[model samples]
Target chain A: MSAADDEIAPLPSGLEEARSAFVALCGGVGGAKLASGLQHHLQDRLSLIVNVGDDFDHLGLRICPDIDTVLYTLSSLNDQFRGWGRARETWNFMHALGQFGGDTWFQLGDLDLALHVVRTHRLGSGETLSAITADIAASLSIPARIIPATDDRLRTKVVTPGQTLDFQRYFVEQQCRPRVEALRFEGADRATVSTGAESSFADDTLAGIVICPSNPYLSVDPILAIPRLRQLLRDRSVPAVAVSPIIGGKAIKGPTTKIMQELGVACTAASIAKHYEGLVDGLIIDEADAEEAEGTSLPTLVTKTLMVDPRSRNELASRTLEFIQRLGGARRIGPQ
Target chain B: MSAADDEIAPLPSGLEEARSAFVALCGGVGGAKLASGLQHHLQDRLSLIVNVGDDFDHLGLRICPDIDTVLYTLSSLNDQFRGWGRARETWNFMHALGQFGGDTWFQLGDLDLALHVVRTHRLGSGETLSAITADIAASLSIPARIIPATDDRLRTKVVTPGQTLDFQRYFVEQQCRPRVEALRFEGADRATVSTGAESSFADDTLAGIVICPSNPYLSVDPILAIPRLRQLLRDRSVPAVAVSPIIGGKAIKGPTTKIMQELGVACTAASIAKHYEGLVDGLIIDEADAEEAEGTSLPTLVTKTLMVDPRSRNELASRTLEFIQRLGGARRIGPQ
Candidate 1:
């Protein structure tokens, strides 16, 4: 194995204690980055249960922004400069759309459009998004398994001060300008947790569940909103840890901090912990906020949460696995 | 005015000619070339009615290939190399799609996708294809008015030796390799011709009709298949001429000749002339196929039919106008 692969090797000490799978819940951008980091460490043992709340119909195409972001990021094809979409993307299609007087508010690059096209075609043919996404990720040779939180439609509707708008309209077209009042997953009442995700949780060999650092209300909530998903997570007799999206009262990316304030929540790690309170057994917060971690009820691990480089990601991932091992009551079987 | 424009000006000399409008029925590629030629000469005076038979649900986006081709070609945005879609296009979206195991067979370039996305969105929101097309054309500043044959669903299904497939499947996915036994326009029986086209036909100020050298069955037939459209043409007191797609007993492009033979029709100018016997008042054949014109019952005119360059397109178009004048017809006055 290469030096990079050697560094990415599963913790021998933790593995000897108990071999367990890791399921990460994620959204777009911020979540995707952390998911990529986790995938780097866990490799084939990672199961990504991505949120579909941001999925919306645009120009007759069922566009799953979060799913696509995670998929592209995991495959290392994500446009890091843009922080979303595939690397080396082009906007020629969007330019023509402008010429045609079509809506160009939400820019879809050429490479990015292919995913929407294929997914839309499959969905139109009655194939579930979960199945199609699996095929797409598999085709890309992504070692980690990416699955939708649910097959049923669960649109994230942001109820702002004046009106409720579709997620994209709020996030993309409107540029998240509206003051958030409440957020709701429209189809969550009817949504069942994807069978694959449920199976992962039920599997006896399941190791750990890591909630990737995504927007709590906008990303993670939608996945948890699926009627039985929270119950399943609560019932799972395995270590579940959440990586805090906020550090020092600010979101690492997106409008998470702003939205938190607008919704009358303090933009702090405490707020994040309060949100995922009942679901997680442990919380991974940045070392910068370690001084404030003592007050939290959950078992806390202070680590460098920011994934600025590959080393940082691997270091955080290793610490997270080690913390899970200690919390699971597994005996450490190797040298530190 | 230019010398050629002066000679072909609307209302030439003293002649009690029948009032007719120059209408061209078209599909994509080959049809768009002729349509572009006619538009260049006739300007707003030409009504280019495009076939909607090939429009299909691709990746949940409503893709109207013929209408888009005509629109793109007239606007000078068509990619010459691909013979369809926009010029200066990028395949970033398509390449990304391949990575995701998408149905890359029907390549939707990034720039090309914008049109589909916008059209599909507008269509889903209850906008008619005619209105959307008009908006698109006007945005592109196209001089000629391009209209879809119908606002209702009308798909061309090609019945190959093994099975019947949609037009895109036969033309794109199957690479037109399927030996066509028959072709049917699904939903054509209930489809109504677009109001814009119907109004153009009903207008008493029409000059003369010119059928572009597109495939008679695949392109023109679908337009004629609309209920009351053929009858409307038959009852019109105007000269209607058809420019034969066949040149020296073969199609200039596409499957016209092959489909003709499969359907047990002779793949010749005589056969094309016979197919439009009652509807067309005259027939235009290439100079190379002048020998075959003797057997046709309609008044025949010979000219170089190939439009490889702008000069060739204009020359053919000019000859077609002159033929209409000789047959005792005059161009209409006013903007169209």
Candidate 2:
């Protein structure tokens, strides 16, 4: 057993007869962390529906940051210290790109390019993004079912005060420098849930949904913006819990808090709860935000939610799963 | 003046008024060497119409081997010592490709990928190969018109005794081990010369056509196989001269002599002249094959053609241009 497995509670007694399958929604780095913990905790039974809002064609190759992050994280290839990409990755491609005066703003590592190349080729050959993502997961020996939110081109267009920007342009190229006004999922209205994702959530064996600590407006909201996907999630009878991305009025990573403040919302755990208020059955806030958890619209689980290490990640995942089990029982389901 | 200038006779009195413009046809490595010499010697007055038969899409990126070789060679970026690709290049991309279990037959350097990425993007955007190549040349400040023989998809498919293979699959992946039966230019029947290549050849100040020491049957032949391109060269009134790839019954680089021997042709300067019999007005052979030039079908220029260094390459290029000028005076146009 991994060090992470030691912290996770064993499958709840009656459910031990059959391993429970779960569907977790996630975005990039922050979401990948919690999704990784759940992957380690639940192993084969977990399905991670990653957001496709951040997907972009850079230098002619389709790059899916969130799905790639989940794949790299679960496969133990992610660079934790650098906060992105594969460990021990070389930046020769980027350096050489600079030599040619090609776009160097978006960093592409030599090792990272292999996945992009393969994905680009397969996509060019008419394979769907989700299929390519799953094949890559299988190639990396990642056991969990990693799914893209939708196969269609549902790009996140950040409508800042000055202009609209592609997700990568706003997040990476501009370093999230723009003031947020509103966000748009370019193709979300027409897009349906990816092939197996909706069914995975609707399955009889589905225990619950864990909306990981990804940015609500930028990350998780794009996936939910797909009308059918949102309707399907809303229609599901099982308990859906969200681990608050905000803790003590700050996001763990990325532009979540900044974007929230720009959108004129209070950058606190309570606002995060309110953001996903109608979708989730309960909210899991960090111990730092336990005081802010008062008078919440939904049932709350306050725990040590900062997943700094493998042990902490597992502990938080175990506590959240345990909380889900308790909520699946007597707690009245409120918002759909 | 360069050391090669010592052997190069001054431009004749009448021709000294205006520096002449020349159109040279070439392929990879060996061709690049001589093309570089002419580019240095002629500066802006040279047009290098590179063979496009070797172009292929690998890892979803359009790679024009001969055109890239020309670009890298003229820009002083080509890896002369290692044979192909850019200098001071890193193979981290290939290593990572190996890690992903990607195709490892054809080697792609990290620096090289930048060009491929940019080209692939441009090509996907509906721009022709010639346009992309010229644009890249401009980006690198390559002065000569680095034109592809044709922008159309005219691939060189090697027909070995066993089976037909793509140019790269035959040359790189298989290491040219397959015994040649015949080679096929897949789209030669319908392909036309690139937009500006024909006009460059037919210009008023056009001096001559120099066929560099690239493999005649493989590299140069594919360009000639393009019906319009061959007809255009045939229709040209100016002297068309060739430097024999063979010197002392051996090719300087690649499988020229081997393919010649396999194709049931004698590997001699005389045989090279015979191959280009109807097309070229003169043949330039090395000192080693001076005896083989005796009673050859075409006018022959015997010189020190072993271009082992910069001076020697320049010397050969200067000598060939002088031979073209000399041939332009005394020779009667025989083949059309």
Candidate 3:
């Protein structure tokens, strides 16, 4: 761990629930923030099953946006102000790339590009995405095990009215301005869960799952789209709780709310719960949405779901673990 | 063209010989500097036949070091202080790569890496090296046509007593410490000369060839090792002259002198002339090696060959062209 990570104050230190391994299904920025919170509390006991649906081949390099964000965020190397990529990054590579008429829309920071190059080289040599991510996480001193949902090629193709755009084309290059008609996980059926996540699912010490505050359709859906991974989630006896990405009828960052609105879904905590109705035992909403708690059919935990800072993220994580223990109804070892 | 290229005062402006198309067989650094001078004078009329033997696939990117050096040099983007790569280059990529436990021996500057990424991507998409190089040169606004000797894979392997090391592994990683027992071009036989070079050789306006002051055995020999390119050189009626890399019994840069000693050959202008033999008509020797003029069988031009600055490079190129004109023995258009 870095000197910076050592200085984080180690939140939720007294929470014994952290000893039992928990997995968070994550997307990019918003989800990565909560994943960082879980990582801090659980340390090595946490596993982040990051979405690979947004991963794409650009400039012959394998670029996994969500995985990289989680790696950077947990390692405390992320740009907090920008809410993405490594801090103190340079644009010299992009500037030079523009001089050669290369695609500049993705905005790959100089420090961020090194990760892409390493991942591309390793992937080209037949190394799995999960293995590479694990090594990179270790290199960045990220205590949590960051595994891809699947090692196989599973792309999320966004179906707009006129075109079927690649995930990055819709998300990054197009700035998500295109109204989403639908979304499809291209190779989801063939994709299988990584051994790391599979073993975590098939383990005795496994605790409840926490679906982080990421977009439901874009992030969580892709993982669940994989039949093998979905089967594992379905067969688990432990409770699976989800923190709502929606706060006060809006997403904190990104086009989550915009996408939801375009897809004809209401921008409310009840709608967020409805999206994950079958998959999750309960939904954790923000204090602003506490009024809507009785509106959902499933059980609910209303808290400050907006992780404005590290402290708020830790509080939400600790509360969510307590809620999951309540939902499971048996796996509790009380405070001595 | 950049404002920097325009700021460079044009040289040999009124010389009618500069109108005639001349091709320079070049390698890296030293040759690139002279090629820059030639480009300054000849512009669109100059063609650089760059050696591709030193090109290697490093970390999944096709890195053509010599070609990049020549392009940077001719485009006035080369670092004057470092004598290689782009000026104002950043090492952020290398720094970040080290964090991932990546290979750090071959230092890839952030600005320089953009070219490799572009080239590698294009190559993966089935684009030829010559075509991509031409596109990149055009993007850099370089008027001189920079042509790779071959589009095929041709690597220079250092055959030391202990092991056969890759050119970069020997040159950069080991810092050229190992004694050079021998050297071999891995795929020279199958490689064909680029169309840009073949067309230049076939052109009626072709004046002569200026073999730049790169290492004779390692650089120029690789081009000559290709049977077709050698036959074209042998068949050319125009005078082929060489600028001797050796001066005052020492090489200006690289392992030229050490390699000569290891191969049991003397480092002298006469020895350089002997190495070329029938491949070149005359040799351009530095004034420092004026005493060795009598020792060579071929006709020699004794001049200041140390290209300390841009002006020196221009002066040497101007002198070499003048010598080639004199060696050709007939065609002259002057005092227009």
Candidate closest to the true structure, highest lDDT: 3
User: Residue A113 in candidate 3 has what lDDT?
Assistant: 94
Each candidate's chain B TM-score?
0.91, 0.95, 0.94
Worst 10 residues of 3 chain A by lDDT: A5-14
Candidate numbers sorted by TM-score from highest down: 3, 2, 1
* Ranking, lDDT, top scorer first: 3, 2, 1
- Per-residue lDDT tens digits of candidate 3, residues A68-159? 99999998899999988999999999999999999888888889999999999999999999889999988988888998999989999999
What TM-score, to 2 decimals, does candidate 2 have?
A: 0.94
TM-score of 1: 0.90
In the range B1-336, model 3's lDDT, one tens digit per residue, is 333444444444334644688888999998998898787778888989999999999999999989999989888899988878999999999999999999998999999999999999999999999999999999989999999988878889999988999999999999999999999998998988888889988878888898999999888888888777888888877889999998789998888999999999989998899988878889999889999999998999999989877778877888887788787754344321
- What value does the lDDT take at residue B73 in candidate 3? 89
Please give the lDDT score at residue A84 for candidate 1: 86
lDDT of 2 by residue, A72-176 (tens): 888888998998999989887787677666788889998899899988998999999888887778878889999999998899999987689998999998999
Query: How far does residue A336 in candidate 2 sit from its true spot (Å)?
Result: 14
**How high is each candidate's interface RMSD, in Å?**
1.7, 1.5, 0.5
DockQ in order: 0.69, 0.60, 0.84
Candidate closer to the true structure by lDDT (higher is better), 1 or 2:
2
